[model samples]
Target: MSVPSQVDLASCADEPIHIPGSIQPHGFLLFLDAAGRIEGWSANAPEILAGQLQLGLAYTTLPLPPACTDLIAECIDLLAEGEYAPAVAAVSIAGHDYDAIVHGSHGRVIAEFESRDVPADTVAMFAVKAHSSIERVRRQRSIEGLLETAVRQVREFTGFDRVMAYVFREDDSGDVVAEARRDDLAPYLGQRYPAGDIPAQARRLYVLNTLRMIADIGYTPVPLLGAPGAAPLDMSFGVLRSVSPIHVEYLQNMGVHASMSVSIVINGRLWGLIACHHMAPKRVPHAIRMAADVLAQVMASTVQSIEARSDAELVEQSAKVRTALVESLLIDEEPLDALARHADDLLAATRSQALVSVHNGKIISHGPIERETAEAIVRAMPADASDILVRDKLGEWPQDVHASVGKWVGLLGLPFDPPGGGWCLLLRTEQIEHVSWGGRPEKLAQVGPLGERLTPRGSFDAWHETVRGHAHPWEATVLANARLTQSELLRASNARRAQLDSTRAQLLAMLGHDLRDPLHSINMAGTLLERGAVQPTLGRRIQSSSNRMQRLIGQVLDMSRIDGGMGLGMVFEPLDLAALVEDVIDESRMAYPSIDYSFANPGPTCVRADGGRLGQVLSNLLSNARHHGEVGRPIVATLAREPGWAVLEVANGGAPIAQDVAASLFNPFKRSSLHNPRNRTGMGLGLYIVAQIVREHQGEIAYRHEHGQVVFTVRLPLAEMERAGPT
Candidate 1:
């Protein structure tokens, strides 16, 4: 048979399995309204109650045994008191023993009576059986051992021919991981089943009602007959709820006459099922079913404990790696550089084939991946993506992305918070999987007596499939490690930002203090000149002090622009580079008259540049030389012309820059306190501003300590007019 289209499989999930409106023939149902009136009764109720039941009649007046009536009354009282938990009791109805289960549903009460085929177990017997089973389950330390034990105990308790513990994968498909069965039966262990076998609505009901039993797959559905305009009864908690027609056909096709499933819910999620099957019609008494429910609960709890312990171990191990990475980030080195250094640790932590980091539009990889592949993979990520993405099957991804992903079939990407923060990606190569499915794992839409509808595949034989373009599934431990690493990276980035803010605060405070001295000199000189002491020395003092104040203010403004991500604005023009250098040298000579200054120019070297910014650069470099150089050494400025370029060098005699300070030489607020502490009165924005302005002019700047002197070089392209001789 041809498999159904994806649409047909999805439509199956939309069936309203919760409100089936009917139940298996083994039970009778009645729904009572808030006033105790019977608003709904199953079609089989008339024959079971000897034609004495009627809709809208009070349940208290029904012809039921005192045991059944008393249980219903108590269930009603509990509902009146806001308790909705279901209550069950053994009762004799029409001389036949039955299990009366009552529960509140949708502001009404549901009463169901299931005929008992075998004698009910005493409470003591049930307790002993449950305790022994639960103890056996709890004693198993591993999940596989625990599930194996659970299946054996359930089969022993229910006398089922086959029992299997099935576990759901991340995709909702399931695998029978453990099984206990009669020697005559074929084992379902290790057989995979597709997600369509259960459907979404069925999975939901499984969570709502943790235990379900189908006494006979071929039994007729007993539909509920209700008052006019009455809504379909909600059988979400119904133990005898009539399952989907497709599910019934599915079991028949597998040669199963009866079935029972107890949900394995871990942390409130339907993790899997303890499925039981028999070759003959088998109706398990309510007590045995309840005992199985209890055992399943214990099994779920034990599984949770085992898995939690495993995850906890991984978290502890990853925490150590994350702590080490964070500590490296706190050091003086760049954060990205630190991440590169710890790339091996990250790979080990995630157990990934490779790792890559993308920040500030730069990519750093630590594996066999080429730069182009890494760039393409990063580009394929959503621009607004902010959460961790884990993809194991590259074949399932969009076709457009496949080309970019290349041979890698798995990608785990963790995006940092606050846009443009950064991203980390872990990559894995493809690993083909040979899966053994329980059947062909497909349903077919067939035209039958009821028209076109999906039917379960009529095959139970083992089928083999070769799955390609998939990587090894990322373990829960790996995912947890990725989350932990992402959290630490965010925390470290925030801390770094905080430290930068503190540094900015200190720089501003120092700028204010440095301004006061220059401002006071200007004010005092102006007062002296106004008092008829108009000496050339006082006039020069005012001019020098005013210039100092201007330079100080310019540095502050330039720093603000750089910090705000705004580059320095420039007006490009052709100018004599030598003249600009000479003018700055003369100004600096006067500013520090006590220090020797020298200048050399190879004629007029013209370049297109921002003249004022370039002058600021020269003044800052000269001032830096005077403040740090030997007291008697000359601050030399040399300008030369190269092919299509103008080169300028500023050489100052000084001890080489400290390794620590040189690490961030052009970074803002990087003043050296090791020498001339008084000269460090200004904010350390001079060198940073110079670097920024040089970059804006399309020029190159470099610093070198060689030949017993520190040399700062700037290279700018010669202007077209300068190169072509005024053409």
Candidate 2:
């Protein structure tokens, strides 16, 4: 990620705020000595601080009114550890209520007391309303509907004129996807805002505060005072903490007179914001903000689930298409011809408009492509272009190629020829977009009384900008497809090359290593179960991983049977690939939570194959993704179906697989590290087992490297086995 510009970055972090010598007028502050005597107090301390007496008086003797003394004393139990938490309690004295914040700093106990006249009946009312709202939000099945309900519930609870669900993008910029507003207000839905609008320091504050409010944008900030040479106080935990000036200006420019915000945080990061705006100055009760916090928890969990789901879908789609392409290549003796036969499916699987296969200095074009353009693409290809090369914009092409700007704006290059001579290029045409921003994105310089200074935009009118010279950047689904196809074609080429100089002793050398890891685990689990020390999750892992191992062994044995001129021991039955995909993702959640997954199931993709063998294929593919893919980013899996075939793909982002390794990807003993990266187990028969299974099933499996990810795919034919079909 690149650093955002400092000009637009607004943070008042360095100002001496602890000794600001003032406090928000709505609150009274007191500093206590070691013996609990009042040392210093805010100027208005006399009016609401219990009409207490002068200096050196014990603060404990000032108020004993409604059992708040015990709560205050309990707060100080951990004061030695510097626990200065806010929002301790709501204590009522003489028919009025005040919120208390008692904290310890520098061996001195400081107390802040504020009153919004917090109604006595508000808690009971809010509890009932929150319970019903939570039940309704929990009923939503899709993430879109869930978060939409969250913002609506908050809007109703807070009585704000407008409320928007603002979710952050990959670049930290935000978009308003859901909104609730009065009819008189203009809608801010679907508008994009720049990153620095809330700055870095403010983002940190949000995580700490969880919820913040500005009663009136036009009100002056009340400064907290300290001694002349004292350090500033950290008000990060203060409920009435003032906001940054730039943010206030930003709100004013948007025609908002008052605002309140709830931090929708997920796993320690600020995922998004629930922003509430009022056209008039309005103070939201503190009790309502606390209720909003409850909804934030629901939104955070839902968002995490949605992100994981999207990743799983992408993985499913990539697996489907790449697997299909690889399977097609295995059937045809001439790969170029196979490419032509599967042209339509390949294009459909990837986010591309065309495919161009260049071999022996000759170009075979498909789907609205030209020979000259294909030749130029080959010349511009990278040196080691065996891995997939993706370019979203066609910059500085030759005059002839450049002439077709909108027609061919994006390109994906997959080299098939030994070095850089042959290539398969996927193309994407330009897509024009109209963008709306909350304000003009550019900064302005004004010659004010002070020297030339950069100022925030004065107006936040809807700014429209027409964007061009771009195409839909190849998504992980298509990139994974490309990588898987590249793998298969390269493996096939290597097998053909080996035919000229192959030998026998080294043929099955890799199988010399035993598949003992799963067997060992199964043995241990069985022993423990016999001894009555049963662990369900452990037993399940042993069962699942061992079953996959058995399928792999069966696939190999079946291949050996064919090689030895013996009959096969295999069963065929129709099964839904989508169901298998869901099972794999759910298992991965428990086993490999570090890797985010996207499983895309276009529909009910079914194939006639051995269910156990296919599960092995999926298990191995996901295992490979977890070990080989990038951390933090989603590993995409895809399942696609055609007239007679089902394709499954697994794609992950990381360093591109090198040409030498990709060439031997399907051969035994060519193992990559697992998730831990330190433990190197197994005979490396995973892909070899997968390839044999695909071949026996009369389908195909392939590999490729695209968009910095290694993608593997398995393809199988769908059979018309009836309900009574035997295996």
Candidate 3:
């Protein structure tokens, strides 16, 4: 027989081999087939797998047990596919559905070993050992699962009466989501701890030390190293490790005598804590604690996993519901009905009792509570406050009603995106016995004196001692989800409102500017005519003003049509470029009689463009130069042909445009601060319209400044002009 390679044997050695001197004396050696069936087993397997017989028997060829055959088959399939090749599979053995390490090779099970078992008091310690290898393998799995597993392992390994995974809330509160403890202790799986209980200082210390231990609350304190005698031991803990004395006192007050805490660091910042609490005084050896710390690190990833998965599920569900609501509103135009229909589902999904309220400064409709009662509650709320919770006055309510309603207490006020329109209110009530407050009872007394006294009989009795009647007010996760939902809705509403307002503003500005220029010219002509200046020169000037007004009116019509998506029809006919330039010059001279105008055409050039629109573009550019550029400085218009296209250049001796202004010059309603006050006659749309018209003709326009002057140029494709025939 050939021997296996040393590397392969070494790899197997690194696998989950039985470690001697474990708390449990029994040892197990198991061999599984490619299908995870028991191909071979050692004599010691039965002794070690005592209570865990199901798992040991699973490896056998005998008919698989009905209880776990499917689970084993699934694991074997995963191993065969190499998905679990590098990782140990924590398979349950028979009745003992605990954790064990199973290794596989080449689609076949190679070896398996059960971790040492220990005393019930030390089961948590043994679990830690059992999970170390699996924990390491989990690092390569999902990060979120890694965190959840880490937390679960810590809780199960430390023998803490209760282990909680807590995360910080935006409101500085903390929530308990994942919890594990012995059967003797009450479950705190979904409890929420108040922010006041943790306090700012305690949280700061918890973050400083990622790992902390209160081995024995009653143990004597190790005095400070420097008591004016011996030098300090310089025993400062790791930044990820620190103990809070106040927290210890708080726990002691709660009857907890020992605790261990580790920080859950995400992206190098403290995300939350994994806290393990022991009800009775306990002492852990240094080695065991070190092992716990290592396991804690491994388990952090698992805790993160569970949180992420849970959050993803919540978000997905929320999205589905939100989509349904939004679609229903769009389709049926009945938002209230849609919300009502989903009330129970939303409440159960969010783990809160929700009340929907419609209000217009006064309550209109409410669900899950009487309208009169809701209004009274709303009226009693502080003016500036939108939400309030009263947990102390539960006994005041009518006894029959209170009994039916349960002892849960929570109040949430959701104002409409634009307040005073209509709003929503959600109230959650949990059974009263589950409520626990970490703060002093005296603090509860302080809020009791408010005139809102609770009646001691009937439904009102539940309102008495209100502080103690409610489950801890909104937890970090609940509040965060609520805020996220509200913010998204607010953002969408604001964005839509902004878009509508922008469109309205743009339309109004377009109308005012487009009509103002022609109106001004007509008014000017009428004023001049009323003065009785009938001289030949004055008559010609008045005629010119009327023509300019007519042209402006035509430009406005064309612009409106273009903006309305109406196509600009072009008449293709051979046209002289020189004539077009000359016409533009004459029109500009007439429009701005005070400015000098010049034209240059290099040769007899023929091109095709809509004569009216092309002339309007040229006239607008020249007019802009006369009004915005330096007046009295000659405006020069030039036309030339380059290889594939014709180019028209309008140059003016004017103040150079600043680089920033030049960038936005062609945008609608954009005017440089340097524009002349006397020429505020245009609505700043001349260049914008010019660019648009030119682009429609398959041409390009650009602006540049040189030698104390700014120049605008238009380039049109020569071939396109030929296809269009002419202007």
Candidate 4:
């Protein structure tokens, strides 16, 4: 047979081994629909059954003995109930006993018949051997010991020339960690196989099927016969499914004629495999293979148990480190400084050479790494990665970055959210490793009897390589500990920020209270000097400065009160909103005599609001217009009545607020720094206080820069017209 070239790795991986539409010569397969009518049959079916087998023929009417048909019928019944699993039975066909394996696949019942080359063992006898093998495997505490016992027991049970336990690594390459073989056979223990040796699709099938066998690698493949235009039968679950030609060639090159593999699966992931090889053509009876499956399962559970215990120890140590670091963060006033104190412990816990924490936009680190290197490492982190990330090699970096990590080859990262958004990183130095492969681990093109095509490498000798620029992989327990630490740091950081905000507000309130008495004394002194007509000009200037100071102090007190959760107290009543607007405009005209002013008064618009708070809102909005408006432009104010509401609009002509500053225009402590700096005054609380007063009245306020003009609008619910009264 001409095998496809392996030059194209993608094509080699795409090879469809599942629907080969054939079976090995030692067994024949028959595909039947739910009604028990034969829809397809292997080309060798007639020869094996000793009678003609036709498509569309009822299986029960076949010339097989009654036992085989009854067994198949029961399997078909199970398929109807959605409980179908592979079942095997011994039955006589044409006076010769055969092993019948039945299962359901692709909406059809698949039956396979393998000629009996050896007598089948009784259930009691197989159970005794299986129990003995499983017990031996379970008694071992370490994974190495368990695998060693498993290979020995499987080799004894199957009588294979060689048996090896192969464990897969994270990269899918595998090592033959344990082996049992005859004295004359060459040892394959500790030999590694490349991931490409078994394509990706083949690994997936191993997980699904779990157990597979090839009685003879040299046997001819018998094709299946089906109706015209019928889709190729899906033999994914077929017991007698044909093996891939390339795989058959691989085994022959290795001098393995017969082979069996049982999967070691744990927690739904393919962990490893138990592979058995024979130098001569050998057929393992169905019962022996089942026993090997049981032994494999026991080995898998024992491995899981050992791993869990190992992880538990690591977790205990990790908990101690995490607890210390978290306590430092919560107890110490400076969290980054606290982390620095425990840098060595943090590094040792994750097996790293360096530790760095990015907090409050500052890099605090205790390691040999430079500040530039730390920044680069943080920038290299994948934005889409979750809270924690692990990297062991430079090859995994994104394309735009350099494929080098200097002296270090691995890193672990934890990203912190804003207040100061940054990352914590741990770096690991490179470790050199020496690896031994079963062969060169490369597929080469060679001319065989059929043609010049890609075939398995001929050499089975060990090949060695020195691997460099990689670090020991990060463990699961380390990541778990990092996640726990990340969660605690976030919580404690939030608590600290809240406490700081509360303290600042309390300080502001205290300063506002303490300065009021001194300011009142200054105002009283200025008033006396003006009444005495002594230095009247100086007295007026002093009074003017004191009035400005008084307003600034009042705004500060109002902001502190709101921030401290004491909301502005208000008494709602009906008043003429137009009158309030006119009074505020009159005051603004006096405050800035040079600026032109205009008012559009919708007379006597009644509104439900606290008259004092509403007057403050009008005053603040007018003051904002006066301060920020263009020197020659007129400040305009208007009041209007809409359905169920009263609308107040204040407009000024000037440069619109920058997009960056406009978003926080009404937020406390914002400044007009980007505007006319000379006009900056009163802690920038004018618009903020106005917005708060409007909200307290259950009104909506909005600001927009449109058509080269900045406008502020307030909408409040209207009161009954009958309640309108003069203020």
Best candidate according to lDDT:
1
- Give each model a TM-score: 0.64, 0.58, 0.34, 0.63
* lDDT values for all models: 0.79, 0.68, 0.53, 0.76
Model 2 stretches astray by more than 4 angstroms: 1-24, 28-87, 93-95, 101-114, 267-269, 327-332, 335-353, 357-375, 386-388, 394-407, 411-426, 447-453, 474-496, 499-727
User: TM-score: which is higher, 1 or 2?
Assistant: 1
By TM-score rank, best first, the candidates go 1, 4, 2, 3
Q: What's model 4's lDDT at 269?
A: 76
Candidate 3 accuracy as TM-score: 0.34
Most TM-score-accurate candidate = 1
Writing each residue's lDDT as its tens digit, candidate 3 over 1-727 gives 1211111112222111111111111224444555564433333345444334332245544332333344455557777466342223334454443233344444444343333334444655565574674555366465444545655666554656777777665555565656667778666555555566554545555554466666566544322111122111111232111133344445665577877777766555557677788888654433344566556555556656766787777777766766654444332212343456566655654566556544335343434565555555555444443333233234643354454444434655444334433345567665455434333222222222122322111111111123345444554455665655555444544553454356447646655675566567657767877997554565565565666556555655655554444545666566676688887787667756778787865765667677777887887787777666776688888888787788899899987887767756655455442234755445555776777678667678889888977899999766555545558
Off by over 4 Å in 1: 1-15, 19-21, 40-48, 81-83, 120-127, 223-229, 311-320, 358-364, 367-391, 395-407, 414-423, 472-673, 676-727
**In the order shown, what is each candidate's alpha-carbon RMSD?**
12.5, 22.6, 24.6, 21.4
Task: Give lDDT tens digits, candidate 1, residues 400-516.
Answer: 878777777688888763454477888888887788999999888897434688788788788999988889889978887788787888788778668678887886777778788
User: How many Å off is the CA of 534 in candidate 1?
Assistant: 38
For residues 559-659, what per-residue lDDT tens digits would candidate 4 score against the true structure? 76654445577898878889988887888888778988899777888887888888888877777787778778888888887877888899999888887
- Number of the candidate with higher TM-score, 2 or 3: 2
Model 3: CA > 4 A from native: 1-203, 212-234, 238-287, 331-338, 341-350, 359-367, 375-409, 417-420, 434-472, 475-727
TM-score of candidate 2 versus the correct structure, residues matched by position = 0.58
2 or 4: which has the higher TM-score?
A: 4
lDDT at residue 408 of model 3 (Cα atoms): 34
